[model samples]
Target: MEYIYASLLLHAAKKDINEDALKNVLSAAGIEVDEVRLKAVAAALKEVNIDEVLKSAATAPVAVAAVPA
Candidate 1:
């Protein structure tokens, strides 16, 4: 979702991930801002550690398929 992307962009840029910031990013990107969703995302990320989340995601294992000879 664009909302999540906006949050990630802010995190990547070391900006504050708040409703206002999310609105600015969305508006700048020509996407319509949804206040309800923005607030929800901001609240959800309030206690999240983006760095740790990304690190864990990077280290998560993936299933590989075996090729038949």
Candidate 2:
């Protein structure tokens, strides 16, 4: 869980976010995780509001770009 949080932080700190980045982050942390599940988690996580996860480090704030209509 902590590893997930850290990964999110690294992602949020970055200009771009993706599955590869998330996997790299977790792998670097010594966590062996499923790539598919990780991607699913990352996708689900992206939908999470950052403000709700500020109290703890388990969640991360993702930078969302405004899409042109």
Candidate 3:
């Protein structure tokens, strides 16, 4: 969970998302860093465009319920 949050934090700050950076963020937050998770997150984010994903998520429609009269 922290690994994912760290990735998002790095993306939000326009910082390079890498294992060392993610570890730094986790360490700064006083959380123990897990190497495997950190590497996994870095690899997962390698081809992702965080900003574009956020934009599409924001524009996605939500279902609304109609109230009965």
Candidate 4:
């Protein structure tokens, strides 16, 4: 979603991820901003360590199914 991308952009840029920041990103991208969703995303990531999460996700094993003959 655009919201998540915007948040990631903010995080990657070392900028604070809050409602105002999210609003600016969304507006600049010409995407309509939703107040409730913005608040929700900010709150959800408030205490999250994105780098750790990404690391763990990257190291996690992937399940691959065998191809049928």
Which one is best on TM-score? 1
Best by lDDT: 1
How would you order the candidates by TM-score, starting with the best? 1, 4, 3, 2
- What would the per-residue lDDT of candidate 4 be over residues 1-69, giving only the tens digit for each residue? 898899999999999999999999999999989899999999998888988988898888966778899
Candidate 3 lDDT at 56 equals 90
Prediction 3 global C-alpha lDDT: 0.88
- Arrange candidates, best lDDT first: 1, 4, 3, 2
What's the lDDT for all of these models?
A: 0.93, 0.67, 0.88, 0.92
Which window of ten consecutive residues has the lowest lDDT sum in model 4? 58-67
For model 1, how does the per-residue alpha-carbon lDDT over 1-69 read when each residue is reduced to its tens digit? Answer: 999899999999999999999999999999988789999999999899989999998888856768789
* Candidates 1 and 2 compared by lDDT, better number: 1
Question: Which ranges of candidate 2 are over 4 A from the true structure?
Answer: 55-69
What TM-scores do the predictions have? 0.86, 0.56, 0.82, 0.83
Q: How well is each residue in 7-55 modelled by candidate 2, as lDDT tens digits?
A: 5576569633457777777778798878787777767767876546654
- Kindly report which residue pairs in candidate 3 clash with one another: none
Displacement of residue 44 (Cα, Å) in model 4 is 1.0
